[model samples]
Target: MRLNYILSDLGIGLKRNLTMTIAVVVTIWVSLSLFGAALLAREQVDLMKGNWYDKIQISIFLCTKDSGGRGCTGTEVTTEQKNRIKQVIEANPDTAPEGVFGESKKEAFEQFKKLYKDSPIVSTVTEDQMQESFRVKLKDPQRYQNLVSAVSGLPGVDTVQDLRQFLDPLFEALNKLQWGAVAAAGLLLVAALMQISNTIRLAAYARRREIGIMRLVGASNFYIQLPFLLEAILAALIGAAFACGTVWLGWYLFVKRQAEATFQVWQWVGPTEVFQATGVMVAVGLVLATIPTFVTTRKYLKV
Candidate 1:
């Protein structure tokens, strides 16, 4: 019976302020959607890092006839210079347990051919043009600077390249995008909260006379506040539901279907990540609705 009365009042409050309720719902939808996208973006970046970072190695390029390396001398690297670089890398504690693998000029040439086979310049390059280098795998890829700093000044060492350097900019950009989404979402959330507060205030004001009669009849504050709280929860819930749908659809269309298809070499976030984001959005939506309504009703409900 009490539940039915609360439900009835909830319906009345919702009908009485339909426009404001719709506004709150739309605000929650946009805010929660952005928030969920930000969460999914974070998960996507992590997935990419875990997939790519582990396999990346530091390549210490030796001087070639072209002299393209930063610290390289005019002449090609000698066998002794190569051996010395190998020894230094093997001796580093951060280097992976296995000995450093040296790629010969011929092997480098072959790889370059395979890589640039479709490019016009592949025919112009020769084996002698390739730089002999040591591929040093690290126990921790983040310790790349340790190896690079150690080898950068060594004789015949032209340039030390961490494959991570190629990836860092992309990851940083993605991180910035994630934070940007989060910032935008945060502002929208504030707007939603204010909208909810105003909705509750107006509902309370419209029902002030009834609230006074209820107060005179000895109705509790909780009973008086229940309908308004329910209204907020209902609007937020609808908004969260829509937000979850959009987030999932966005991931499925853009991330899973499009991105994963195009970038088969790298791992991407999938349904599991979307589900996690939706779960958070739903919780956030419920909280976003309840707190402001609770606060506003306590002050304005009159009962």
Candidate 2:
């Protein structure tokens, strides 16, 4: 009998403020969708970092006749100088085990030709013009600057280039994008909460006479508030369902279809990440609905 009354009252309240109920549902849906996207963005960034950071190589180029650097001379670097440079590269504590990879001028020229096979410059370049290099892999790519400085300006060394320099700007931009999404989602979440509070307060106001009568007849506060709580919970569940769907579609089209398909340099977020973000969205939506409804009912339903 109590459940029947509560359900009937819930239907009445929902019908009375149908407009506000829809608004609450739409607001929660948009906010939670943004929140879920922000989570996926964070996961994507972390995934890229893990996939690419280990493969970072610092290129140490030796002098050639055409080289121009502080350490470079007009003549080509000698074999002894090259051997000495290799020893220094291997001796570094940050150097990964068996990570010193030497590329001879012939090998470098071959790679250069393949890279620029379509360009006329490939014909002008010769093996003697190509500089020998050490492709040094480090245990910690973030400390590449230290290794670069240690090898810079050594005899026969022309230049040291860390791949992270090329990649830093890309990562920095992605971090900014992630934080921007989080900020936008946070503001929308607050708006959704405010809308929920307003809905609950308005419902309680409309039922002021009934609430007062219930209180006077020794009806418990739980009985009166149960219907309102259920209304909010039901709306929240609907909004969360829509938000989860939106998140899944976005991830499928953007990450799975486009990013993972086009880019092979890094791993992209998949269904696992989508599931995690959607779970959080549902949990947050329920809490947002319940807490505000409780507070509004307690405050407004008091005779």
Candidate 3:
């Protein structure tokens, strides 16, 4: 009997402020969707880092004839110069002691052919055209600077390239994008909270006569406020469901179907990530609805 009364009051409140209720739902949906996308993007960036960072290496290319390597002087790197470069790498504890692998021109040519097998450049390029280099795998990939500083400007060292340098900027850009989404979501969430607060206040004002009777009949604050709280929670729940659905559809269409198809080497965020984001939306919705409902009823729903 009590549950039915609460449900009836909730329906009346929702019907009385239908426009405001719709506004709250739409606002929460957009905010939660943006928030979910941000979380998923963060997951994707971490996944890429886990898969790619371990494989990153510093390539120290040696001087070659016709190569514009620093101090190349139109001469091939000598055996003595090569040995000196190898000693520098071996001496650095930050670099993997035994992870130094040298690729000769012939080896570089073979790798080029395997990589660009279908490209016309393979037919035009020759073994001599490829620059020999030392592949220095790091004990800790973050210590790339130490290895590069040690080998740069060495007699045979033409250039020291850290593959991570090329990738860091891309990751940084993605992080900025994630934060931007979060900021937008925060603003929208605040708007939704205000809208909820106003809607509850108006509903309480409209039912002052019944609330006065309840107060005279010895009704507790909890009983008096239950209907308004239910109304807010129900609207938030519906909004959160819509947000979750939008996020899932986007991930399926853009990330799983499009991105994973093209970039098989890297792992993308999956359904598990979407589920986690949905959990966040649920928590946010509850907090946003509960706080405002409790505060508004306490302040404005008195008989």
Best by TM-score: 2
Clashing pairs in 2: none
Writing each residue's lDDT as its tens digit, candidate 3 over 1-303 gives: 998999899888989999999999999999889888888988999999988898888899999887676647778999999999999998999888689999999999999999999999898999988999999889899778888888888887888899888899999998898888889889989998999999988998888888888888888989999999999999999999999999999999998899756858888888888899899989999899999989987854454
Clashes of each: 0, 0, 0
Question: Runs in model 1 with CA error above 4 Å?
Answer: 68-71, 301-303
Shift of residue 58 alpha carbon in model 1, Å: 0.6
* Candidate 2 Cα outliers beyond 4 Å, as residue runs: none
Per-candidate Cα lDDT values, in order, are 0.88, 0.90, 0.89
- For candidate 2, write residues 1-303 as lDDT tens digits: 887899899999999989999999999999999999999999999988887888999999999888898787788899888988888889889999999999998999999999999999998878888889999999998778778888899989999998788778998999999999999999999998999999999999988889999998889888888899999999999999999999999888877889756847678898888999999999999999999988999975566
Candidate 1: tens digits of C-alpha lDDT, residues 1-303: 889989889999989999999999999999999999999889989988988899888988899777866657688888888888888898888899994888988999999988988999998888888888889889988777888888987988988888888899999999999999999999999999999999999999898888888888888988888898889999999999999999988988887788746748778888788888899999999999889978887765454
C-alpha TM-scores of all predictions: 0.95, 0.95, 0.93
Worst 10 residues of 1 by lDDT: 294-303
The TM-score that candidate 2 achieves is 0.95
Native-vs-model 1 lDDT?
A: 0.88
Ten-residue region with minimum lDDT total, candidate 3: 294-303
Each prediction's Cα RMSD? 1.7, 1.5, 1.8
